[model samples]
Each structure stands twice: as C-alpha cells, then as structure tokens.
Target chain A: MVEAEAELKRLMLAGLAGDAAAHRTLLAAVARHLRNYYRARMRGAPEDAEDLVQETLIAIHTRRDSYDASYPVTAWIYAIARYRMIDHFRRHKRRGGDHIPLDDAPELFTAAEDQASDARRDVMRLLDTLPAKQREAIQLVKLDGMSVKDAAARLNLSESDVKVSAHRGLKALMKLMADAGP
Target chain B: MKTDDLIDALARDPAPPPAPPAPRRMAFALGAGLLLGVVLLVTFFGMRPDIGAAQMPVMMKAMFSALAASVAVPVLLQLAKPGRPLGWRIAAVGGFVLLSAGIVGVALIGGDPTERFQLWMAGAFPWCVAIIPLLAAPTALLLTRLLRDLAPTDLRASGAALGAVSGGIGAMVYAMYCPVDSVAWVVTWYSVAIALCAVLGAFAGARLLRW
Candidate 1:
C-alpha cells in the first residue's frame, strides 16, 4: 500500500510534468480503488458506486495540477473522492424523493449465495422500477458502507427519508422478485 | 450490467460540458476569487479602519489576492469540472488568489504599512475568513457528490488516498503562499487552517454535493 502511494505520487508528479503514459497509468492504477471507494458509498447500489469511480478518475486527471507537492498523495485523492460523494447526495435532494436506510437492504438480499449473481441483478432491476429517490437510498445505504447518519447527512435528508426510501425500495424489490420467481 | 461494464458505461458517457474553452473556466475562477477577495478586503478595511496604519503595498495586496484566489479558484473549478470534486485544490486556488489580491489592493490603494498590527486581525478579518465562504456552498456539494459517486467500487482506496493528498496539498499550498513567519505558526495555525479548509471542503463536497 505504501509503495503504491509512492508510485502514485511519482506518477502524479510525472503526469504533471507532462508524461502522458504516467498519467494514464496513474488513472488506471487508481481506478479500481476509486471504484471500491464509490462502492462503499453506494451501499448496495454497485451501479451508482461504479459511476462515482469513473467520475472521480476523470476528475483526478483534469485536476492533477492543483495537487501540492508537499502533501502526501494518498490523502489528496481521498479528499476528492469524499467531495464527489457529497455531490451525489445533493443532486438527489433537488429531485425530491425518499431514500432507503442501508441496513434494511442486506437483510433483504442475504438469502442467496447460490443465485447471488442473478439475484442481485434481479434485485437491482426491481429497484430500478421505483422512484429515483427511493432507489438511490437503497443503493447508498444498503449496497454502500455509509452510516445512516452519514448517508442522510450526505443526501441533505432527514434520517427518516433515508429509512423510508430503503423500505420502499426493499418492498418494491420483494414484490418484483416474488412475481417473477417460481 | 456487470459492475465493470457498468463502470465503463458511466465513464463513457460524461455529461456534455457547458461549452469549450478550458481557459474560460480558469478565468472564471480567477475572477470570482478576485472579486470575493477584493470585496472582503474592502469590507475589512471599512469595518475597522483602525487595524494598523497600512502595510507594504506590493506584498500586502499580493498576499491578500493570494488568499482570495486560494479559496475561490478551487470552488469555481470544481463547479466547472466534469468529475473532479471541488475541495482543497479549488479552495486553495480561490482563497490564495482572492486573499493575495485583497492584501495587494490594501497595500496599493489603502495606504502604507503604518503598523496596522492586530486591530483588524482582532475584528473583521476573522469574519471575512470564517463566514464569507458559505455563500458558495454549492462548490462543496459538488465535491461531495463526486466522492459519493466514486465510493462503491474499486476506487475506494484511491479516493481515500486522494483525500489525504488534497488535504496535505491544501496545507502545503497555504504554507507556500501565505506570509506567516513563524515555523510554529506555520505548523500550528497555517497548517491547521489548511487542513481544516481541506477537510471542510471535502466533507461539504461529499455530503452537500452528492449527485
């Protein structure tokens, strides 16, 4: 991990100095890590999490010059990632709908190790049927690792809104899955 | 879609930018930071014209403008950037530019350093530094959304790492540009201010800016 950071910094500096390959390498190396970071925020919504990862990588590339040489490179990346997450919450807020509590979600999906892959996909599809707000809450709290308070705060929403959204998302998921299952 | 496929899709389809001319974005940042800093400096002078008696014209205004740019540039850029979160980099750029400008304007237009020691520092400077940035809350929100959006996948570690780097950079940038003299002052006050700003920018961006 430490070595990776060093490499990232070296590559970052190199990229800033106009090395295209280093820049590309820096972005690719960090891409997966960014995805995981976004994933945790996504709660249960891998799709949304993935979206964040891609966005952050691009941000890093364009804004690389703003980085200060005196600081540790790792922390800077985290700061950007953190800010992006906040943006995610605000956009959903303007749309005005409920979000789900993340905790309620694992319970909903814990049943299938065997069919987990397709089951998860089905769950996501069912989730897609609901209002954008409710779906987002589930994606955040349930799929992502964000604490309810943190997630609620991010969304600029009351905890209840987060909770209700998760509930509704889950209910929608169950209904859709039940209807399709044998 | 598979997670990887999903990510590819997201990466592939960025929102069309408002327009082109990347320089325009940088210019806007410079402008906003300059404007905000100038206003704050002017106000600071007005509120407590009794600070000292003016300082060095060249250095002071330069310093003030620097501060303002440090805060404003990062914000405007963050707002404009497609995926980048607006936090320390944007804040530092805005704050530095604006503050530096204000410092310069004061020295140039206000008067000479008649030793305006701590009067203004004790009065309006605090509020200008503390309260004013809230007007641009949207910048932080944008950053947060960028972070939240990236959190759920392979990018988590890099994100955290990036946050740390940006925080460190914020501190370094403030240190590099601000005219604080003491090492202890640099380590204690300046560094802390940088960290605080960086953290605030990131935290606000993460929560307030979520997409």
Candidate 2:
C-alpha cells in the first residue's frame, strides 16, 4: 500500500509535468482505488459507487492545478473523493432519498464485499470478450505490470501500436461493461 | 461517462493546467474591488467632515470591519481549494463571535443604553443596508471569476463566506462616509448588511459554483 501510494504520487507529479502515459496510468490506478473507497462507504447504493468513481476522476483532471506538490498525492485524491461523497450525500438528503442505509450495518458490510467481488468478476468477464491481440496487449501492458515498450518488444510490435491496442482495448472494455450493466 | 471515458477525456486535454495561487488571486480580485468601492465612496458620499470628533467611532468601525474581513478572507482562500485543511474555519467563527460579543460589551459600557435600539434602527435604516451589497457587487464579480476554475467542495458555504467578506470590505468603505458614531449602529446595521450579502452569496454559489 505504501509503495502504491508512492508510485501514484510519482505518476501524478509526472502527469503534471505533461507525461500523458503517466497521467493515464495514475487515473486508471486511482479509479480502482476509488471504486473500493466508494464501495465501502456506499453500501446499499452499490451502483452509485461507479458514478462517484467517474466523478472523482473527472474532478481530479479538472482540478489538477489546485493540487499542491508538497502534499501527499493520496491525501489530495482522498480529499476530493471525500468531498464528492459529501456532495452525493447532500444531494440525496435534499431530495429526501436514502440510498445509504445507516440501520443495516451488518448487511451493508456483507453487501459491500459481495458487490466488490461481483464487480471484479464482471471486469474479468468484460476483458475476456475482447479480441485475442487486444486482450494480450491490455493484459501485458495494464494488468501484468509490463511497460508499453517492453510489452511491445515482447510481442514483436511497435511501441505506438501496442499503446493503441491497449487504449482501444480499454475503451472497448468500458463500452462492453456499461452495456452489460442492469 | 464510465471511468475509462472520463480518463480518456481528461488526458486528451493537451495543455497542463498550472496550479493557481489561490490566496494571491483572491487578494488581487478583492483589492481591485476595494479600490473601486473607495473611489465610489469618495466621489458620492465623501469622508465624514468632522475628523476630530469622529476619530474614535470611525476607528471602532474600521477595527470591526477589518477584523471581520481578516477572519473571512482566509476562509474564502482555504475553501476555494480542495484538500486544504480548514483549521482556520474554527478560528474564523470564534473570532467573529468574540468580536460581536465584544462590540455588544462596548455598546453596554460606552454606549447610551436607552437610545441603542433607536440609533441602530434609525440612523442607517435603508441606505446603509442597501449600499453595502451594492458595493459588494464588484467584489463578488471578482470572486466569481477567481473561483470559476477552482473547485470548492461546499459551494454554498464557500459562497456565503465570500459574500460575507465582500460585505465586510464594502462596509469598511462605507464607514468612511457614514456619520453615525454609535457602536450599536455600526455593529447592528453593518452586520445586517453583511449577513444579507452572505445569504445572497449562498444562493449564487450554489448555482454558479456547480462544476
């Protein structure tokens, strides 16, 4: 976790320096973390977790300039995420809706774990449906901890070609995942 | 949008946004508005003519307005940026409450008790109330501009704080021309005007600050 935090901070700083790859990597990693973060907090409203994750990611992009370099990157990200959650709560409170059940404490904990595993399975299933080349490209570059350059060298492809494959693969997966949702 | 699409859209923006210096930006905007308010004050209402007799009262009003401003400015600066700790928020509220209570105490000791309500209501019935928010308009414009790009977590509260600060600065500008010498008048009427601005700011912030 400590190493992950440090790596995120480094990638974010690099992103601020106009490194697009770093920016993409940081956002991808942060999205996973945020999914877990919101899932833990939003028990009854499991669906809202994904929405909050996207909102936080967008906020991180737009408000990148407000981030102070002196602070821990996770601190900055968590603050924005927390604020976004508060906004969600405020909106729901004003509308007189209760998606977050305070009374179902034990059930919420069980539901959170079940939802998280179901989400992981759903993601894996989405990845499984992609073309072989694109799936290999994504797994090598994104899931298997291989740099695009190394992954390209291993796959006997150009670096840019590998990047395009991974990018398309992710986009396709997102569309598939969204379509597969209830 | 899905997280991936959101990420793609974010990375697609070519130019890296440089972090804005929030405090300096706020100061510049409010300072520019203060200059405009001062110009208006001198042109229309001119400073109180009796400088000798009005020294202490003028000084008191200045102190109160400035103190309120001092508390509010930091709150605006801090709240405008996410991830910043609002330790100053507590201090700001404490200072405001203490200052208000102290003003009441002064009203009790130095002020004529019988005429306090009369002076508070009568001296600046409509003009003092109306003028502060009018003067705050320019500063509010400046604030809105500065806060446009920045993300405030709580828009309503941040807006109210900005409005209150703008009002305090406006009242300070008005104090130079206001002839009323009573502490009750300055505390009561100026506060009402400032509070009105805060309410206005809350509504405006809620709509305008939505990202």
Q: Considering every candidate listed, which one attains the maximal lDDT?
A: 2
Most accurate candidate by TM-score: 2
How big a share of the true inter-chain contacts is recovered in candidate 1? 0.01
Fraction of true contacts kept, per model?
Answer: 0.01, 0.53
Pairs that collide, model 2: none
Give one digit per residue, the lDDT tens place, for model 1 in B158-189: 22322322333333222223343322223233
TM-score (0 to 1) of chain B for each candidate = 0.37, 0.84
TM for candidate 1 is 0.33
lDDT score for candidate 1 against the true structure: 0.49
How much is B8 displaced in model 1, in angstroms? 10
lDDT of each: 0.49, 0.78
Against the true structure, what is model 2's DockQ?
A: 0.22
